[model samples]
Target: MTLAPVEYAVIEFGDSTVTGDLVPALTELVETGLVHVIDLVFLSKDADGTVTVLELDDLPEGTAAAFAGLEHDIDDLVNETDLQVEAELLSPGTSAVVIVWENLWAQRFSDAVLASGGVLLDSQKVPQDVAAAALAAHLASLD
Candidate 1:
């Protein structure tokens, strides 16, 4: 079988302004056959300088209800050690959402490449703002 492409993202938000919609959004992705969420983790730094970590199973009752449709086993691809490294960058009283997702939409393409004897290459995501700027530059150059 061709290997599935995986991607990870870490998103940070101020504690007072945070509203987590990841579970519902991920559910939509899974239902749409776009991506499969392999891992979901929440990290928070309190004002008292203490850090908190939780996986899907550890979420609060009210919050856990939102993730009822998760399709994969709740696991961590970005483990504790990796989370600690990232936690150091968070400001006090801030929170972050970490997710690892497989590109379900690309499996067919990956299989085709493998069938043609082509090796998989590195893949990376372009930050949205940077991609927008790039598109603007290309459009300007075409004028």
Candidate 2:
């Protein structure tokens, strides 16, 4: 099947528990058909710098149940190397969730581009702070 672009993000909760609070927002994205969850993995680093990786089944009963709805059959797309690279960014006593998702909203556009023989040369996500600064500058210029 033709697929849309897939992207992954690692969200870190410094020195905190991985509460399933973000589940609702994620559920909304999926339910809205904006994106499809490819894989999700949880990681934590202890005070001694020991890293632990947890899949859905490895999470606590409550946490696991909360995240259960987000799971799809497309698993293991985020491998050990991917987890390790993200884990290195976590501080001791911090936890993170790595989520890989298909940009379902862009599927049609991507398919059309392919059909037209167009190629994607590059893509980049601007940092939030930089985007905010640029917006502020533009607003100031308009004043």
The segments of candidate 2 whose C-alpha lies over 4 angstroms from its true place after superposition are: none
lDDT of 2 by residue, 112-131 (tens): 99999999999999999999
Q: How many residue pairs clash in each candidate?
A: 0, 0
Evaluated at residue 134, the lDDT of candidate 2 is 100
Clashing pairs in 1: none
Error of 2 at 77 (Å): 0.5
Candidate 1 local lDDT, 12-31, one digit each (tens): 88772234466677788898
- TM-score against truth, every candidate: 0.81, 0.95
Q: How accurate locally, in lDDT, is each candidate?
A: 0.77, 0.89
